[model samples]
Target: MTSIDAARGMYFEDFAIGQELRTPERTITSTDIVNFACLSGDFNEIHANHEYCKRTPFGEPIAHGPLVYSIMGGLQYASGINDGTLLALLQIDAWRMLAPVRHGDTLHMRSTVVGKKETSRPDRGVVTFARRCLKQDGSVVQEMRATLMYRRRPPA
Candidate 1:
């Protein structure tokens, strides 16, 4: 097996408000939708029944909101921006599904550091990121603010 160097991502002190990271795009697929449905037990017709969805405003089965949210998490990880520096996912604030995500649609994420504060604990600090999931057409399909804790770099 080939060994790959682990990425030690930025610590809390390395983040600045307005710093943005864009992730690579990924296309949604029917298999992905089915797998997510099986894993999440969300069999909503809007997400699972193409025939039923054909009558809806979206005109076809759309991906689940939580599924898209999960993909955003993956996209962030793939960016390697928080590989090892992340302490915890503190909270998700103001999450919104702005548009439908249908199979075959390509999506990508753009995350901007919107807020940061030192915690009372000396070991970690909070950082808030404004994350947007944009479609191939450049329209936003989802958006949210995620607050996370990151470890502080040790003194040199």
Candidate 2:
């Protein structure tokens, strides 16, 4: 189903392996970096100092990895596929930063269900999703696998 029709959250039983959901796009900005720097207390030159960044391979100030990762988390929620059905994030695995995210970069998240299993609790289950953060050009800038807890379908 399209995002418009699937705005409601999905239950554990609703997910199928290889099923993909794309989130609305977002643009990265300089103010985002500044705000993140202040909020995270991470004043790294590569993230907040243009002059310092000019000497680096990226040649420009880049957003913090964690900041972009955090944005992906928000995108996941905004996608609405995990809305109220999601219970908790169990784990993040093999998270990798493959490219620098700079100001004006439009990005979106693609989440695919990769695995699922019933838990001891009949009311909930575990789901593993492969998440990819892609730039407007279709380049994957970051990727990770996350395990989450989700409720099962309720009794009819």
Candidate 3:
């Protein structure tokens, strides 16, 4: 995995509501599409067969929605925002695929802290982030709200 940035990650207390974080751009390649298809066994024509896709509105093969969603996880990891601070992914809410992701489309992720709450455990907190996957053209292709458990700072 290529690390886009060597920056340090933040603890739960370090995040503020509305603070945004971005991941480095990644270009979707035909190889990536093929690999995802083989791995996922989702050999749907729109994602695999070019000739079949030519008959569709897209005019060409497009990446699978799940593939794009999985890539978002990689992008978030590459961003290094959670790193050692994340405890678990508690939930994903309101996930939507708004646009098709085609091969050669460059994409990036933008995440904003939308909510935060201290947990009764004291050592952990819950944070909600609104995340979007945007194409290079600035159109949002996918979006979701994610809730995560994060490690809180130890007492000073």
Candidate 4:
């Protein structure tokens, strides 16, 4: 485990390759679907109507893929990455949806550090991670890599 600060004081040196950090579990509900629909203007029938979705291969109203991505991104912020020494998100790589996320399912997310390197800038560093989003059954719904820049510990 990477020795991250307990109360939002993370620095570049605290992260390690292959460290997995899990976010708090979240439940997806019908209201969440509606609210996301309103916010995103994605009125696609499969995400809105159970009846319509039942006719499809999925057999139930599945959450929107983008909504799932948004939830995964939100989970990162909720886990204190931004609250800690976050400076900026440098890039997202290979984001892909693997399975349908359905309403009423419990989801959990984790980010595993893939690599880290010091930047040319002495006061910052770059970290790369692959985040996994999984259902309560532990099936992966989404996976992606994010490149982040964080403030390094001050030179003593």
Candidate maximizing lDDT:
2
Ranking by lDDT: 2, 3, 1, 4
Estimate, for each residue in 1-156, the C-alpha lDDT of model 2 and write its tens digit. Answer: 643433389999899999998999999999999999999999989998889999999899999999999999988888887887899999999999999899999989998999999999999999998999999999999999999999898786
lDDT of 4 by residue, 1-156 (tens): 766455574688889999988988889988888889989999899888888888999898788888888887787778776676889989988999999888788988989999999999999999998988999999999999989899898766
Model 3 C-alpha lDDT versus the unseen true structure: 0.92
lDDT of 2: 0.93
For each of the candidates, give the backbone clash count. 0, 0, 0, 0
Which numbered prediction scores highest in TM-score against the true structure? 2
**Tens-digit lDDT track of model 1 for 50-151:** 899889999988899999999999988887778888889989999999999988999999999999999999989999999999999999999999999998
Q: Model 4: residues >4 Å from true position, as ranges?
A: 1-9
Clashing pairs in 4: none
Clashes of 1: 0
Give a tens-digit lDDT track for model 3, residues 81-146: 778788999999999999999989999999999999998998999999999999999999999999
Q: Evaluate residue 109 in candidate 3 and report its C-alpha lDDT on the 0 to 100 scale.
A: 97
When summed lDDT is taken over every stretch of 10 residues in candidate 2, the lowest stretch is: 1-10
* Better-scoring candidate (TM-score), 1 or 3: 3
Question: Candidate 1 vs candidate 4: which has greater TM-score?
Answer: 1
Q: Candidate 1: give the clashing pairs.
A: none
Q: Which residue segments of model 3 deviate by more than 4 Å?
A: 1-7
Model 4 scores worst on lDDT over the 10 consecutive residues at: 1-10
If both were scored by TM-score, which would come out higher, candidate 1 or candidate 2?
2
Better of 2 and 3 by lDDT: 2
